[model samples]
Target: MTAPQPNTAATAKARLFGPGGLRDEYTQLATRGRQSDSESREWSGLSVGHRMAMLLLAGVDGDLADLATRDWRELPGPEREAIKSEVRAAKVAFSRLVSLSGRW
Candidate 1:
């Protein structure tokens, strides 16, 4: 039998969580948020907090999509609830981060 193929999504996630990855994205987002103004025409009028929150939500959705691709059976019950919890926590944390950056 051929060797099993690596999960590309997992590999991508590893890179995203590695040094100079998601952290760097966060830094850029914060910097841009701080520099944003009411007159700035970008992102269709979405605030920095809104943008960050959407980014956070996209990450969570990616995680769930990866899980689904691996095995849909793993998403039921506690696993699903855990993802929900993560979404809630991320929303709060992202909001706090944006607010702390004085962009809120």
Candidate 2:
């Protein structure tokens, strides 16, 4: 029997937020200078915007981190629009979380 061919095309989420993507980039920045596995666990618990804020505080490029919450223009129209909507909700949630925290 012949083996099935691998699907080489990256999925929308993988292309936008998986390895080597903007989310990974920000995660790398946020976790920089850390020295323990427990810290990794803690970092994993953080939301996307919190990770972005950590990256900002670490003096990394804010533009790169901001890309996570933006649409992936490289994707075709429908997929792009879908991902954009999802990211928009994430941005709104993050903003509300930050705003609520500030009031505490």
**Candidate that scores best on lDDT:** 2
lDDT of each structure? 0.51, 0.53
lDDT of 2 at 13: 68
- Clash list (residue pairs), candidate 1: none
Model 1 segments beyond 4 Å from truth? Answer: 1-74, 99-104
Compared with the true structure, model 2 gives a TM-score of 0.28
Global Cα lDDT for candidate 2: 0.53
Q: Against the true structure, what is each candidate's TM-score?
A: 0.27, 0.28
* Candidate 1 Cα deviation (angstroms), residue 70: 6.3
Q: Give every collision pair in model 2.
A: none
